[model samples]
Target: MEKEFNKKLNHLTKVNLARYSTMRLKSWGYLYELESFHEARAVIQELKKQKRPYRLIGGGSNQLLSSWEEGVYLKLPKADLHLLSVDEKKMTLSCDASTTVNAVLQLAKKYSLGGFEVLTGIPATMGGVAFMNAGTSLGEFSSLVSFIEWIDGEGNICSKEFLTSDDRAKNFSYRKNHFCGEGEVITKMILKATSRDDALEEKITKYLNYRKETQPLSSKTCGCVFKNPAKEMPAGKLIDGANLKGVHVGDLFVSTLHANFMENRGEATYEDFVALVQVVKEEVFRKFHVELELEVKI
Candidate 1:
């Protein structure tokens, strides 16, 4: 069974990653595009046996890749992104981890389910969102997640249930989560909607409009570059106040529309992104006396 599974794995060497990432950095790396959860489990086991390193890539919205990567990268096929189930009576929705946030939002709207407006304008998959507890000023994804399923490093499936009061404290926090550690991959999730709103469309439109007005949504960016230090002091405000807006290093620049976002003008390199981040961090820290934490993964 292991041999067959290993043979089924689809891999590529020196794969161009410009299309995989939102930033579109000119980068290359090895990749494994697994077709199903079983394939993912098998790949994990094989990697363990070979003592090789691998990381999962989802949507590539919040990641910044270098010019070249050494280890293997794994991705679930887009075919796995399906709406598993929806129980209106329970106000619950289940979906594959590969499902995009936009797709999930559409599903919720179709069912007239609410409580996902907080995720408006986020370009990410369910797995990536759950892994990072992605959110906006409204609330975090942890608030809606009732159950999570993932594959562990040892090639075993694992899961956890979250109650209304325990999800935030037990598993999630500001732009971070305790689950989905190194080598683990989130497979599916069951999210509980807070209400059934017939006006869900209007709500989502408002949210999207707000984001469009405040963010450089049309530009190529990996969402927010840094996490907000506190509710009162947002990273964008700090960076803007420090006069980092429109600052550039190579082809990357701090967005004037939203200081928290760094935009790729054209053909930006990984080194340029890193240099820009360091400059912003140093400037923000020197002025605010607070060290900003990266929301974008490297």
Candidate 2:
């Protein structure tokens, strides 16, 4: 830590009144944002000392924050981007938890790299996306990742590779990665991608344009409120059929644009969002005999 930062730490706290998400009115979380990998490790130790539970945070684009949290909210600080190496046929990018996924994608696009382009419009950092397996049909982040690295609870760095089928099985669902537990923090991620120029740009433009038209790119809410069921029914369509296209509770309302999106209209409470989610589920189940499962982290 720098001399100035050490001075700031004297006043820095684990508990904070910070807005936790980018969309739908703001909800509150006790923000414990870290700015460096060392700072992240230090913050985890602090939380362990206090014996308080905490959740990791990214861009806050795809999650809901409660107005009142039951535990500490750990956010990776905002200056962890470090470009490790970019090769001829493949590229390797390693980033701290604080680096947003968009930043990495932007860097790769400028260099004419292709694999990360599918994630062009998705928000959050590479660490967060890797943890949650964030992706779109064009591709999920897991498909592009070759190895993952993180800081253990003991404060030691470790790396894991799941490129082969056998190794990949350990991850229940790429979307359901359970490695971090409650207090562990991701340090960086290394991924390999095909090197292509014209095709990569074209793919990126198509996905980005489609995302803008299909999703409320301008609205606030965690992206895609629920996961698609294995039975082939989309949660959004179910919610819409149940007549929840304009549903609202407090300032939280389902996006008029997409049923799966819950817009935070600038002053909604976390309670409102949760309540609306319940309503959508119950109504859908009552009428269709199908239960809607939430994918949003609340």
> Each model's TM-score, in the order given?
0.94, 0.88
Which prediction has the highest TM-score against the true structure? 1
Candidate 2 TM-score to native = 0.88
Model number with the top lDDT:
1
Q: Give one digit per residue, the lDDT tens place, for model 1 in 40-62.
A: 88888887777777778889898
What is the total number of backbone clashes in candidate 2?
Answer: 8
Off by over 4 Å in 2: 1-18, 172-174, 195-197
Worst 10 residues of 1 by lDDT: 4-13
Lowest-sum lDDT 10-residue window in model 2: 9-18
The global Cα lDDT (0 to 1) of model 1 is 0.85
